[model samples]
Target chain A: MTEQRTRRIDVPVLARVEGEGALEVTIRDGRIAHLALRIFEPPRLFERFLVGHHYSELPDLVARICGICPVAYQMSALDAIERLFAPDRQSPPARWVQRMRRLFYCGEWMQSHALHIHLLAAPDFLGFDSAPAMAARYGAELRRGLALQALGNRIISLFGARSVHPVGARAGGFRRAPSLQQAGALAAQAEQAVPAAEDLVRWTAALPLPAHPQQFNCVSLRHPAEYPMIGERIVAESGLDISVDDFEDHITEFQVPHSTALHALLEGKPYLVGPLARLNLNLDRLHPGVKALLAELDIEFPSHDMYHSIVARAVEILQALLEAREILADYAPQEPAHIDLQPRAGIARGASEAPRGLLWHRYDLDSAGIIAHARIVPPTSQNQPRIEADLADALVGVGLDEDEATLRHAGEMVIRNYDPCISCATHFLRLTLDR
Target chain B: MTMPPKPPAIGARRPRLAVHKFSSCDGCQLSLLNAGESLLALAERVDIVHFAEAGIVDEHAEADIALVEGSISTPEEQTRIQAVRSRSRWILSIGACATAGGPQALRNLGDSADWIASVYRRPDWISALPASSAIGAHVPVELELPGCPVSTEQVLAALTSLLAGAAPLTEQDKVCLECKRRGQVCVLVTKGEPCLGPVTVTGCGALCPGLGRDCYGCYGPAENPEVATLAERFGDLGLDAHAVARRFMYQQSGAQPFHRAARDWRQRARPAAPPAPGAESGAAPGPQPDGSTDSHD
Candidate 1:
């Protein structure tokens, strides 16, 4: 009788990120039997706690959800609640305020993506244990990436009034708009970052990706004028086009047994949304220079491999930088930062491109403009099922024993690829793997 | 003469800092990045040994100074905080979630199971324990930086203190103090609104009031707030005790002191236990289908 094999991978220490996580994979007889990315962090549900609060407080409240993408939370919450109170969308922010908002988002993308590519994603492909280790060996690549990220932060802080959650964005408009001097200062920095960002993209394009292709229903904002940011309709590669108001109609969120977050299915199916989706669907909307650079990379639209997300992120970095420059150039202090929002009682839905992906929020308000009910679906939660699918596929294809280190690394890479913000997922762990 | 041996420093290496996250929005940690160039400069002075958001490759790396973000929700997290506590020399809790269990702690106020069922389809797969609590509740936190997302300047200053081997600094006063300092007229007095600024802490720089709105209390309550006077004042402004209590419970519903005060006032104002849980976990205290407050309220 063959011994019933017990394969388990326990990553006591998860490297290359900001939080605490442990990944476990159990295999019996070579076929995959179990997989769990145990996040044993405490629960901090900002949504449920947001009750009875003024709609104006939401951006600040939700901003506490995660530190990396406070702007993402702030922007999404503001867009959603603003639409809820003002159904007609009467108080659209001025073009300059809108521009500043986009520029801030670009800074986040640059900082986040660079961190992912050089500090998070690069180590996995190069067979190194971590990015810092990779940096130690490839000093030039690491330095350039860091410089690019710093420049991105510089731009983001210019309009955000601070990094993380900027206090400037309110329901009607900014608390205060950036002075012309500030905009000009950011433009000068953007000029230096443009070439460097381009260089990073071209360099990343050369990295070898595993030849594993899976279908992804790329979803992003479809703006006719330019790349989507503050307000736009959502479009996906799978022939689903819906305004942010109708997001719930097409995408249904369900609770999964394995996770705390509500898994979202587009028309009852899993779909992709985030940087790759944004870059692929809105390629034509990119700046001419970015378009030229995209041509040089020779990457086709709707690239199937999830690994290509890095490349897509690079393209986005360029697009974001170019967009930021345009927004800054047209800066006009005279423009109103906010508009009058008369809160009418009803349901309002809004969607916006976060640095990570598309974030959607739904709010049901009473006659007094008080929120009666609220539902939020973040990008990472939507991507969890897809991540599990990809991880399972990788495990089956490899056909190796469940070696702890190998399984752990593979699992971390998969989760990190999506940049799974667990805070966004459950909002809502102690990792307990019952063997 | 032989060269004098290098004098040994009390602490050989710079205090390694590890930033940890559990269930949170990730805003406070992002504040470090939000610091712009200062973040990089700070990074140079002290090693950011471990930060998931900053993309530190080794999650298990040890640190002398550990800045914790988010609340403890799951049983696994309960155990993880113990480990995080063991690894670091000093643990500083950042943001509301760490210092006060955050708004997510609202789950602890009621049936967490209900939340799990309502929000998720497969409740069995989720391993979370019903109530999210503050990091200090579970771990020995050395310092607490309270805010929805703490200010970048605070973060920078905290790092500076750690590098210099001094304690991280914070104010004991409320947003009202800053409001007074800024010479802004009182929104509560003028607009007949209920502002948490009198009770809430000051780190946010009286932002909401400066915009002609009442403070939502992102900085948590001031040390020893005079709640009775504030409640009386609120009633004077035409808001009932219930409305005043509800507004006070807004963002920091999970923080015990505030949660308790709000519930106590509401119960006193209303003779009976409300049909629904008031400020309980998972049961959103918002109006029911009939547009009335739930039992928890």
Candidate 2:
């Protein structure tokens, strides 16, 4: 043992993920010495840009932040701003708006999740370089995946008029309600796809994921009555429950040296967010249909194995589809799609579960409905520390002395497992090696 | 130049396609993915050697056509775009970010360092340039398709034409033209909505205007058009000088025509010198309202 060998593993630009990021694993004494998930996705300075805009513009404006989950941004922004301008939110009309929002969010989760499972994560398990590279062999499965994704897009477009950066959502409600004819047709389609979604869960469960379980706190929004798409309060596996407004107090977002995105430490410790975390904490809140589907699968929630993330995503797609079907089934053409609001002043904070995880927004508005300042805490930033932690633990599990390519692949799988929305976080990865 | 569109793969090697990102929402890339089966069919027609989001990460891979998204916002990105240009035969800059500098380019009108400090805790950790710029500002762009998320139709049409070795048709017609062509009653004229359709290029089929909302110029300026006049009209529509200036500055703030129009309006409206893009960068509208305020209240 004259000199402990030193080497480095480098992934210059992370592939098959949402936004740009890099990872570096340093091997010293044949153990993982250092790990950094460098989120190099350029910060667009969204909060600063929001400063002078009118309250009405927020939905469309924040939607531009991340194309993958524009709905989440729109929903969260509206949730904050609307809660400020309009106090009477429990009226029948307001409840109508809430139901529509939940349905719209369902579409987004469906599209985002289907995309992750098929195009991004599936190839990793199937031993292919890319989804298209696996196209010829897995044609039907790929088509099924795309079809589900297309259906999700249709549901979003039904309300949004276009899926990516949809223009439908507004302060009080939507810009316009989708027609009954279109809404009914989509509901019928969603109903038929429930079994297809169930198939997806089984399909993901069969994937040869690595059985590497680790301990980390799981956090998600937990509502009393429903699986929270728009949540009331956040509850973690460690029983750290708090209101969305208390977020800044409990979850401190501090800048890190290696990444452009800030690292979020919940009470100064790394905690997990996104589908796995949501499933672990709120498995009981899932719809009966979803629960039955889960009952058929062997993998149970509260699963600490990070690979179960893909399975979580599949389960969520089913959950979204089932809910979308139920809500859309009774859809009607309302006279006015949106509720009008008078301008006012105050701090506005709203939180919702994006497909990736919790998205929280706080806006300070002037009396004239102008945004004075804004701050957004996207999920990927919160998960950054946890990702680095998981990478260090899992890298050793796969053997530290393994060749660079093997380690690189394993590292990518772990990150993609989170389905990290790096662009949303001012976020994401690229990897480098040192030994 | 107008070689009758011969089907691609006549006798030459299949063209390779690559997609790249700089600083964007990843919408434009998703537009390609959103093409669904057509995208998979595209994989058959060409080698998709790289597209980071969809799992091909051959960074140095060469290609016939490269679809680049996002704005160049950092020193490293300035160097990176040149490498992308060197590797690809044809480069199509997609979305407002890649073509017009996007909304982030609003800060291009201000000191970016100041903006970063206002937005982030540790400004030292963030590596950003003074200004965000379109890819063409740094490198030669074969074509620029401007949209907030870019139109999938335009991207698909461009792909087909480029693969056929023909120049993809670039639409320079104003949104007003498309709006009228689609029989949308002028919201600006009829409803006194401050629409940007007359100045904005047609790509979205005048979608916002059709939706009875003012055209926000998601697709930058349509070649050379009457921007100042339209912006002036916004003031006449009961908007104050600040509101009028912001319309031009909001979406494609770094595009030359819109940038100039916004600056001119702000200058004319203010007696004193106009402030920077985010004049109150350090401003935080105070703190919490005793922490929580529910809707029921």
The lDDT leader among the candidates is: 2
TM for every model, in the order presented, reads 0.84, 0.93
- What are the candidates' interface root-mean-square deviations? 5.4, 5.0
What is the per-residue lDDT of model 1 for residues B31-87, given as tens digits with 9 covering 90 to 100?
Answer: 764454466556666777777555564556777778888777778778889999988
lDDT at residue A241 of model 2 (Cα atoms): 87
Displacement of residue A2 (Cα, Å) in model 1 is 11
TM-score of model 2 relative to the true fold? 0.93
Model 1: per-residue lDDT, tens digit, A53-134? 5576677667666567767777887787666655344224544455556777778878878767876688777777555556
Instruction: Please give the lDDT score at residue A158 for candidate 2.
Output: 86
Enumerate the candidates' DockQ scores in order: 0.29, 0.38
Candidate 2 per-residue lDDT over residues A1-435, each given as its tens digit: 526898999998888888899999889998878889988888888887777777888877899889999999999888887766765778878889899999999999999999999999999999998889889999888888888999999998888778998877878887678788889889889988877888898999999988989999999998988888884898898888898888988887777778877778898899999999999998898989889878888887779999999999989999889889989988987758877777688989889999999999998987777777688889998898999999998888888878999999999999999888888887321111111
Give the DockQ-based CAPRI class for model 2: acceptable
